[model samples]
Target chain A: MNAFVQLDLTPLLIGVLAAIACALPGNFLLLRRQALIGDAISHVVLPGIVVAFLVTGTITTWPMMLGAGGAAIVAVVLIEAVRRLGRIEPGAAMGVVFTAMFAAGVLLLEQTDTSGVHIDVEHALYGSLESLIWLSADGWGSLLDPVALAGLPPELPRMAAAAALIALLTGVFWRPLKLSTFDEGFAATLGLPVAAISLGLVVAAAVAAVAAFDAVGSIIVIAMFICPPAAARLMTNRLERQVAWSVAFATLSAVLGYVLAGWGPLWLGGTHAVSAAGMIATVSGVILALACLLGPHRARVGAAREA
Target chain B: MDTGFWQAFLAALALQAGYNSALVAVGAGLLGAAAGAGGTFLFLRKRALVSDAVAHATLPGIGIAFILMVMLGGEGRSLPGLLLGSAVSATVGLFLVEWIARRTRLPEDAAIGAVLSVFFGFGIVLLTVIQTMSSGRQAGLESFLLGSTAGMLYADAVTIAVGGALCVGVVLLLRRPMTIVSFDPDWAAASGVSVRGVDLAIMGLVMAVTVIGLKIVGLILVVALLIIPPVTARFWTERTERVVWIAGALGGAAGYLGAALSASAPDLPTGPLIVLVSFGLFMLSLLLAPVRGVAAALWRHRRFQHDVHRRQGLLALARREAIFDRLTLKVLRREGLIRPDGVETPDGAAQAAKVLRDEKRWDVARRVYRDETIAGRYDGLTSIEAVLTRDEIAELDRRLGPPVSVGPRIAGAVP
Candidate 1:
């Protein structure tokens, strides 16, 4: 039990928090037909984090987050510019920008003297979820002790705060966001700033991705962004119910995946644990797949015809 | 760090940097060309990120292939075997992407993101599983993530080169049907071209290019070669066929140059170096291509602004309204249409009279002709002569009976 508290508690909570944070903004992105924005934002976070590491010479949290936020904004502007100037469509423009940025990030990682630090391209992909152990915890007793609580991994609190903030913001701006997403012309006619709302939504998604990235890695971040909300979307037509379902699904996958990753192998009589991050993503994908298969509204309203 | 870098770069550029490296460089060029040509269709179809999903999906296959080979009492490091495994998995991923998109209500982008991240996560799990195997310590599979050419062999290079050339050949043979489907799937379907079949074929060919590129550019950055050149080519021309070959040429050049440059420096990785070179080409095209480039667009905007200002100033002068706008006044003076004191020159008076007559002629013509051919042409920029024959303008002129002297009055001092 002590071992579980010391080693597993923070990572599991962080994973849950990260999953919920990403899924909140993801619901809006999926509806707005801007789902790839999450993918692009996650890819560019590599360069953003690497540039931060190089500049700061240490692996601090805030600088990395700031650099990543700045990079996301830059990528957004660049994609828009390329789309408008070159007359390329949005998909290809996004493809060109994010892939090039990711390549630059890889090149920078290889070129730098980062051997002494724990940060690398692989680390950036998978994150340090398993390593964020709270060694100061002494089983359930530590949960009530302030001194023991102070030794918790920073990501636990950070992810929780981000999840809460995104949830609050989503609640605050629910009406305008819902209005613009479902009926843009009507929203504009109603004197809503449609364009600003769209931009704010993307910024919110970027913030979610950057915050969740440290605990769950980028793979889970991208998956969480699309899978849970997408699954919830299949379950209900109402935006509020879909969001509620998505949060539940995200939380469920995180806890279930973390437990399976840590102990399922042992239960099967294997000695080692697999990656918690990978398992979490796989679990979310499983949930999404299940939702696709069984959800009430999985099929399109009419016979399948894409616009 | 020194002149040594230049010497090395020149040698690599000349393909004299030893046999293995020369082979790798040639292989990279061929691979890049194939990716560029093949990816044009996907880009045109607006499904470029599908390649990302396919590329990432190759990881688990690689891990599985290695474990299977080791269990079968082989060394488990064969490049062809691994490439085959990756190809198989990429095919499954491709089909899954298509299936999920069609079967579910998810937009293709959401499907793409879901498949990419999920498959990649599963692949990572398999990679961790492989690490527990005894022989996995020196598996060197990480190279498939960020490719390395440092110790690559001649045989591996030959396989990649041959595979790349074959892909390019397939692209040539499949180009027509692929083009038809990419431009308009419905039209292709109506014309009995088998839209789904052609699309699947093109995606298969892209998978082939991606598989071959795995050993050199890696899966993550391989999408760059597939996407960048076509976008860059788009800046240069509008024809789909032109885009295909032009992207091929650009991809080949970027590949060759990037491989050579990476060879010149110790710190450079081949995949990123190649991608950056391609990005460089893209940036250049974005800024410099004629008609479509940023510079051209800006110039077009400037010229349009100038024309609008010039025409509006000429109209104000024709009406004898004092031009208050600074840009309008400056344009009139700069065109030698007005004197320094804002009065119309003798030549300017004649030009302004012509302008006012055209405006008046358009006014009468719009009311006279109820047809779109006559009235729809009046955008303030289209000239009256361009819209009608001399006879039509003359008929309108006859309705007004006589021309009014609206030009500058050369101080008929009674005013």
Candidate 2:
């Protein structure tokens, strides 16, 4: 009973919030054909986090977020520059910039004296989701009590704020985003600030990424950014329904993945839980795979139905 | 800075002194060349990022192969066994990308991203399982993620060498068919080349190279080895054959130098260093390569614009007076096209006659040709140096009779 009470729910809540936040802006990226920008930004943020840690001598929230946001902007700019200047394909350009940035992050981490810091290089790569715990909880009721809310992990509120920000931004810019994504030339002809809207989307993705990085890490964040939105895209051609489906899929994966990570090992006769973040990513992937194989709107299924 | 460091660096560089490093370097170099050559076709086909998906997909195979080997009570890290597993998984990944693109409404980029992230996620799950296993030997499997060449044995090097050689051999044997398919699969198919067969062959070669490259550069950075060299080579040449050869050379050099440097500095990982080195080479090629490089192209464009302006100035002067502009005359004299006294030398007479003839043709074309035809021929007229065919000149003559004397009449102008 005590173990159950002591069991923290923050990780699950944070995962859900982060997953939803990532998926919201991720739909625009998918429609824009920039689905992999999330992957690129995830990698490029490592150096940002590490540099922030190095500069501030602490792994605080704002600095890391600021650093990551700055890094994301730099990554977008650099990717654009490489694409335009080298006349290289966007994917290859992205591959070059992100890999180099990630390499630089690794090298920097190795060089810096970060022994005393709570965040290590391994933590940056795979994340430290296991460490997130709320020990002050006495029972499930305490989680609902405002008194016990102070005991909640800071990552929860951080992720919640980020989710709100992303949701707000997506709502505000929904029309321009949809217009530009569907037809950039038309949007430009209409004198819509297509470039600004696109940059705003990138910035929104960056914020969600930074917010999620503390809880789920970059790999899972990247998976969330593409897999749910992509699966949703398969399920529907309509953008509104797609966004709803993406959020639902993301939430489903988060809850199910967290449960599986915590309890699946016990079912399999192991004494310990696996990585919740990795499990989340794996679940989203499984959902995407299933969607690919069995979605009603999938071309294979549609073809079979017609036949 | 110290003698010990200097000695170690020298020993690292001297292949004879460090046999293990030499073997690893040679193996990596061979892998690099094979990937580079194979990657040229992939790049030309505009499927460069497919290699990324293929590379990430190999991780799960390695994990699965290790688990199977452990379950079978054999050593899980057997080179051939692991590589075979990697090859199968990479091929499946390639097939999935193709399948998704073909059977679904999703674009190729989304398909690739889906496969890459999902496969990697599954691999991480498998890795987590491997970590939880009671077996202690599973520790070495993590090296496949980031790559570590320090532990490569001579047998491992030989395996890479043999595999790389086979991939290169296949690429060389089928270069012509591969080029045809890459450039124009429809035409290749129409011309009796089995486009499907060639595509499968190239995909097979990419899978082989990617799997073999996994040990040296790891999964994440292996695609860089496949892409950067070929992309850099593209900045230097337009011919597929030259691109392939240059890409191979650049990949080999990057792999060789990167391995040597990493061997000297044991702290740095070989995979990222190799990528960084190749990236450096790519940057240099992007900036400095002769034809398509940014700097060279910019200079050529500027020079072309300057020539256009000079020719326009000369035409303006010739239109106003029988003599050339002073600046044009100075340039022409420097090129031995004119005398210092501003009279047309034989070469100058030919150039001036050509320019005057172009000006007269412009006037005749304006009156005789319709606006649409003149617009169609606008590029030719603006170039001024375009050599008109005899038929075109005769057609112009028939329409306008002799060339109109619009510009200052040169003595030896073509009539």
Candidate 3:
């Protein structure tokens, strides 16, 4: 029991917080049809992190976060430019820019002395979440104590703060975002700064992505940004409920994925567990699949009936 | 900078020196051509990123295939076996995307993102598991994550060549139907073309190309080979046939050049350098293509705006002779439509009269015509006569007086 409390709870807390943070802005992205922009930002942030490491000669959070945020904004700008100038579809434009950026990041990592650094290319790609440990208490009783809380992994508070900022922003701009997402022309007629609101939403998403990057990596960040909102969208039609459901789904996947990753291997006769981040993404996928199959929208049944 | 580096680079580039290098180049070139051709249809269909989803989705199949092979007492590194697994899984991923799109209110992008992340995540889990296996032959499988041409065997090259050729051949045979479906699926369906069948065929070809290109470009970058060449080709021409051929050639060139460069530079990876090269071509075409390129488009827009300004200036001068600005007068004189001393030429008189008539006609139409009639007839009109009926013209004549006749005092007219 002591081992369980010490070993599992911190990672689980970090995962849940990160997932919820991502899901907040993800709901808007899903609504705006920019779900993949989250994916793109996640990919493009690698070079930002690497460059930050080179500049600061440390893998500290603030510089890395700033660099990643800048890269994410650049990614958004480049994607827009490519889409507008080349007359390409947004998805293809994103694919082109983000993949190139990621490839450049890989190349840069290889060329630089950063290869020996803690944030190697492999870590950037797969992540090392299992190593994020925090043991502040002797056992379960003191786990919630102030000293214990202070000893939590730094990622926990950083992710929580980022999540809180995102939630606050979303709450403040909820009406404008909803109006613009559903009807941009209508929002414009209402004299709302539709473009500014949209940009704000994108910035919020980027912030969320940067916050989640160190803990879950880009792959899980992308999955959280897409899967929860999508599943929530399937389950409910109301925007408010969608956000709520998304958060719920995000938390559920985070906790469930942690459990499965830690114990799933034992069932398969393997001595070790798998990647928690990967498992979290997989669990989100399973939830989305279930939502598709049996959500209140009755998608499959309705399609069959229509046919 | 160093002699050893230069020496190694030269040795790597010797044209006839290594059989394996030549084979890898041919295989990559073939794969690029096939991906290019297949990508044209995908792009035209506006499903360019679907191939990315498909490519990422292939990783789990690779992982699962390796485990199955090892469990069954066969070498898990067999190229065909792994590729087959990837193809099957990629097809399944495609089907899931389609199903989700058809069944739910979720947009296609949401569906694609979901399937891509989920499948890739599962694949990563499987890969971690595979790493712990006792067989210890998992080293070759990691190349599928980021392609490495350094390990290309002659047999692998043959597999790529044959698979690529098959994909290209199938594309050629089904070119007409594929084109129809891609451009206008509704029309294709109405015209007895099985839209779904064509879609499946294209998807099959995409899957095949993605699977075959996996070993060379890796699954992550294969979509680049698929998409970049076709996008670049689009800049050069509007014709589908030309686009296909150009894209294929560009893809082959990028692949060949990229492979050679990667071989020359020991530090560079083949997949990214190839993508970067293709990206370079895309940028060049985007800037330099004659008709659709950015520079050309901007030039066209400027010329159009200038022409509009000149026409407006000419009309303003024609409307009020007191405003006979020197520039407008000079332009009219240069065109031999007007003479000096403000005398209108016959050509100038005719043009001025037409412009006056058009102005009067539009004025009457705007007030007198019903909104629906105006919209139906006058929308996108380049000439006033095209939208004006006899009755409307007569009405304009009665309401706005007879068209102003060009006389000597009106403007300078050159004989």
- lDDT for every model? 0.89, 0.81, 0.82
DockQ of each: 0.81, 0.49, 0.55
lDDT of 3 by residue, B148-186 (tens): 778688888898888888887897898899888888899
What is the fnat of model 3 with respect to the true interface contacts? Answer: 0.58
TM-score of chain A of 2: 0.94
C-alpha lDDT of candidate 1 relative to the true structure:
0.89
Candidate 3 achieves a global lDDT of: 0.82
Clashing pairs in 3: B342-B412, B343-B411, B343-B412, B343-B413, B344-B411, B344-B412, B344-B413, B345-B413, B345-B414
Model 1 chain B: ten consecutive residues of lowest lDDT: B406-415
Which prediction has more favorable DockQ, 2 or 3? 3
The candidate that wins on DockQ is 1
Query: How many steric clashes does model 1 contain?
Result: 0
Ranking according to TM-score, highest score first:
1, 2, 3
The DockQ-based CAPRI class assigned to model 1 is high
lDDT (10s digit) by residue, model 2, range A203-222: 98999988898777887788
Q: On a 0 to 1 DockQ scale, where is model 3?
A: 0.55
All candidates in order of DockQ, best leading: 1, 3, 2
